[model samples]
Target: MKKTKKLFGALTLTLLLGLIVGCGSSGEDKNSADSSNKGTTDIQKIKDAGVIKVGVKEDVPNFGYMNPDTNKNEGMEPDIARLIAKELTGSEDNVEFVGVTAKTRGPLLDNGELDMVIATFTITDERKETYNFTTPYYKDEVGFLVRKADKLTDTASLDGKTIGVVQSATTKEAIEKQAKELGVSFKYQELGSYPELKTALTSKRIDAFSVDKSILTGYVDDSTEILKDGFSPQEYGIATKKANTELNDKLNKSIEQWEKDGTLEKIYKKWNLD
Candidate 1:
């Protein structure tokens, strides 16, 4: 009978030891999975995926736009995006451009749909907290265009008038910021596409369209005039998920090289933006 009791005790002890070992292994696996889950940032994922997805506007001219004449996308920002992709992937052919709106660019980058966004994103401290931004690729001032026949002659003349701005634009934000500081709030409309916004201005649907003063020459004719005097300043930069710092640094170095080599200035002149 004592032998029987000893055998039962051994069996129970063995089962308890097996259970303890199983629990330890399960815990180790859980920890491993936790570490794996925390492992990859956006930059690593981009290198792994081997494709840089770019988000660009399809309608803003000079900066980002699609050409119907060629049935392809073309613009300064798109060209810059292609350059970044080529540098990263050893060929510019690997880029996938997703047309983005002002409201979509931030959330899209946050969600990993885009590797970087070169859609005329404005750099500000408020935005920098969540996303990494490259150095100023372009500097602009928010200004408006009015028909030569219109009585609106200057920035000071925009009081109580309705103005147009692309939604989520730095130009829009700067205008509003300056408006608040100057206590010169005007009625305004948020536009989705630059083409559509420019059309509205030409059709006299809005008193004026406000964007980079540099881009105004393309949209307005000799019958129109720009109110650039005392306009608010803003900077445009490429955007990426905040975790994409390494890739950001690489491209920043590339931009610095471009500046040093005068390649960027050449591009600016090619686009007639300089």
Candidate 2:
């Protein structure tokens, strides 16, 4: 009887010890997996890809434009994109620039088709929920490009007039708010590109083409003039996927460094944007 009792006790102790060791090993394995996952961050992925995909405007000159002569994207934003590529991949040539408009840039970033957008993306509190935006690299204000014959001087002259704005842009909202404040109303024509808006203005299809003053500079000709009235001071920032906060932080740091060291100022001057 004593031997039987001793054997049963030993067996029970062995089983308990085995269970404790198995549970400890399982926990350690889980922790190891979690630690290994840290290597798969967004920045790490960008580094491994050897190229950083950037979305930029191919229409807005001086900010971003596809130069017909050189068949290359040349402007302030593309230059900034190259700098970012150099920082990430150790070569400015490692960047792939995808042309993006206001309507498409968001979708491209959401679908993982582009890593970042350096277009003239205006930062708003509502948009911040969907994407992370870096600190402002440029500041501008909304203005109107109208035919010199219109004799329009300010918002008050635009009552019941049609204003052309880019599709999916904030210009309409800014204009609408301003209209209400001044008790003036205006019709709006939404277009896909700045050139289209300029064409509409030239054709008398719209009374005015409205966008950032800097962008309007590219479209203005002898027949057109930018109104002295400017509103809605816009802050342009680089946007990234909402989940890619690490990449956004890296970009913000780079922008800060550029600003402090006058690198951004030099680029702006190179493009004659400053």
Measured against the true structure, the TM-scores of the candidates, in listed sequence, are 0.86, 0.88
In order, how many clashes per candidate? 0, 0
* Model 2 CA lDDT for position 204: 99
> lDDT (0-100) at residue 226 of candidate 1?
82
List clashing residue pairs in candidate 2.
none
Candidate 2 RMSD to the correct structure:
4.1
lDDT of 1 at 2: 100
Give per-residue CA lDDT, model 1, range 132-194, as digits (tens).
888888887777878777878777678788888887777766777777877787888888877
Cα RMSDs, all models: 3.0, 4.1
> Per-model C-alpha lDDT, please?
0.81, 0.94
In model 2, which regions exceed 4 Å deviation? 1-36
True lDDT of residue 49, candidate 1 = 78
